[model samples]
Target: MPSSPARPLHLAGTSPVHALPPEVKIVAAFVAVFAIVATPREAIWAFAAYLAILVVVWRIAGISARRLAPRMLIELPFVVLAVLLPFAEGGERVTVWGLSLSVPGLLAAWNILVKGTLGVLVSLTLAATTPVRALPGGLSRLHLPGIVVTVITLMLRYVDLLVAELDRMRIARIARGDDPRALHQIGAAARGVGGVFLRSYERGERVHLAMLSRGFTGTVPLATAPARPRDWTLALLPAGGAVAVAVAAWWV
Candidate 1:
């Protein structure tokens, strides 16, 4: 059997999570994140339950901690802010480890760190299982606005081209004895960014014209197979569990 080509952020797998329809996975991820965000920050146990729910999904998806832990670092900026909040925020003070901290600040920090981490994990899970090309079809199935879907689809398709263009510019700068990494070269780097933007806009216009010539409508045709009723139920199980945990957190 021929191997499938690898795409960025997508891990090819034979797990049931990989087999799920894109639309179902999208909806499931959204619901899970919503549940996580809606849960009270003071309910510390609820965050643990949310993490447990994600772990179960990760297990079924064949994703290991090794694969996800590094990606979780993307939330480091939020973590930094969270770390400072207790010291910087003013409210009722409490002592821990010889440092006096604001009670409300501690809660606020916990809120940011926990919610941000859970949200990022949910998104990573979705991206790992779903192909980049399948995202448009999923959004369309969800009945998102046509223009919004169209914009996202085009952005995904062309973002790589813009990145490549930027790389070429960087190489050119290096060849011309200009160090893009130097502090003084910031202006040059900014100018390069502006140039890439102009090039992208022009390319978009050309592509739009080409698409129009081919009788392209506002919405792209979805070639994705429609998901079954069972698919929806199976995909939604985690989200349902999350909702239950959140409600119980509120009630207790």
Candidate 2:
């Protein structure tokens, strides 16, 4: 059962990371992830350097490792898949204890697990610092397609409304003595989902009509002021760190 209203993944903080502009955070997060991906997986020292950079960012952001761990379960399925690689992969093998594992597979597994985890961590760090409401405006400032930003902004805006609507419907069903977990209730659940979709579409149509009445155009302009030069300068620290690490990583 959903207990509270839906909110963004953001955690409140007044750290310097939190003060950074959204576009900068988005770009910095991407740069860090790409740096991690581009580094040769065989270069373990490079990964260590990349992690050190992330740890520094985390400290600046006032985010703790324990706080990031549960949010990182999104990468769990990939980790499970990577864990199987050593067993399923074939070729030169090494024995640890009594069990033999493929060397190439072990390396491949390590690459997947490390890079995937790092990517998620960086993403979480970005989200932790940036408020959800600012994201679309940031994307717009970054010169992303207007349609794409509009769509995402609208989606985020309506997600909470839809969740509340669904919760109400669920409560009504339960009050009628319906058991959603029962075999017969499976069809009801499917139908409920379909109903939510239909209702959501109808609401969207009404919202569109309202916007049209208000002289809405193809794109609604964001009210946020653009990032200043100082913001950009501060933003580059994370990106610069990532680049320097990548350079040193490849050099060694």
Candidate 3:
């Protein structure tokens, strides 16, 4: 079989996770994140449960940890900042490796790290399984403002075109011996970006005209129907688990 084109780092196969209606997954993801966010900073077990939920989803989606490892590194900066919170936090201090660290700060850091990591992992899982095109439709079905969905739709559709145009421009500049690494090349790069924007704007206008010629309506038609019960069940499972974990964390 012919291989599929390389998708964006955040997008992949049409597994069950991907096949679930976009709106369902979106809502489920939001609920899971909300549960994580609402859990107390000291709720270590709750975060662990959240992580477990993510791991299960990962398995269901057939997305290996190895495949996700590189992308997960994107959270490193936030994690680093969270790690520093312990040292900067106020109140009682604890000695660790010969340095005084605030107890509250340590807990705060732990909270941020665990919550943030799980959130990122959840988001990554969703994006990896879901097609980019389905996202706007899901948002619209969930009653997101029409204008907001339209903007997101246009951005996603044209972003790659813009990037490709920019790449071509850079290549052309390189052909002319313009050294992109040189400090003086900064202005050239800026100009190249500006050129790409102008070209993209023109392309957008042409596309709009074409659409209007074809009886383009304000709304994009969905390729799929309303979500089924199975979609809801699949989506709700993780969300329900997250909620249960949150409750247990608070009460237990």
Candidate 4:
């Protein structure tokens, strides 16, 4: 039996979030993130409200903080940048614990940290619920260009093949007493990367030829059931709340 294809960042479940159509989830995620970005940085309460909304969704989706926290570490680089901004940026300065920090820079840092974190969380939530196979169908429903959808579909399908090929090459090298990780073996590692690229290019040509012979068009066929009105309403409710919070942020 063949191995199942990898579904990156997805957690298998029978929760309502998983039951929602991919297209609705995509739209909801986008709308919620847009609201987060448009929100005023000083509206701290609004950010809390946005988080609260996510918490409700997480509860429904059966996603725990334990499973999500480690994934959030992917934004560490941005966090580091945000941390440095307070000391490095120039403007009105204030003393905090005898260290001078810029006021505007603090606000800017907060903006980046809060908004970026929310954006990433929204994306992670979407990915956690939606299967990788459903993404092409979602994109098709959204009327993304046929060529773009086809390219994305093919890339997702074959990227694992490339990774497996690289792994095989690594094992072959290791069997011959070559350590690809050593500094002295950097040149060999570079050559191996080049070899992988050449092989991939050739394989792409062969695949394209085969596809053409089979009467392939430029687009991949992605057939998915349309999202029902109730699905859209359920998915967008949180996004609507986000928008309301954003609008009220200006006054509050």
3 or 4: which has the higher lDDT? 4
Using TM-score, give the best candidate's number. Answer: 1
Report the backbone clash tally of model 1: 0
Q: Each model's TM-score? A: 0.93, 0.87, 0.86, 0.89
Q: What value does the lDDT take at residue 14 in candidate 2?
A: 95
- lDDT tens digits by residue: candidate 1, 1-252: 111232357788989999999999999999999899999988999999988988988899898878778778789999999999999999799999999999999999989998999999999999888888888998999899988988898898887777777889999999999987799999999999998898889988998899899998888689978999999999999999999999999999
Cα lDDT tens digits, model 2, 1-252, are: 111244346888999889888888888788888888888887888778778888998898888898888788899899999989998999999997888999999999999999998889889888888888888888988999877887888788888778888888889999999998889998888899899999889988898788789987856477677777888778777778878877887888
TM-score of 2: 0.87
Q: Rate the local accuracy (lDDT) of all candidates.
A: 0.89, 0.83, 0.83, 0.89
Clashing pairs in 3: 86-105
Error of 2 at 27 (Å): 1.4
Q: What is the clash tally of candidate 2?
A: 0
Identify the superior model by lDDT, candidate 2 or candidate 4: 4
RMSD (Cα, Å) for all candidates, in order, is 2.8, 3.0, 3.1, 2.7
Higher-ranked by TM-score: 1 or 4: 1
Clashes of each: 0, 0, 1, 0
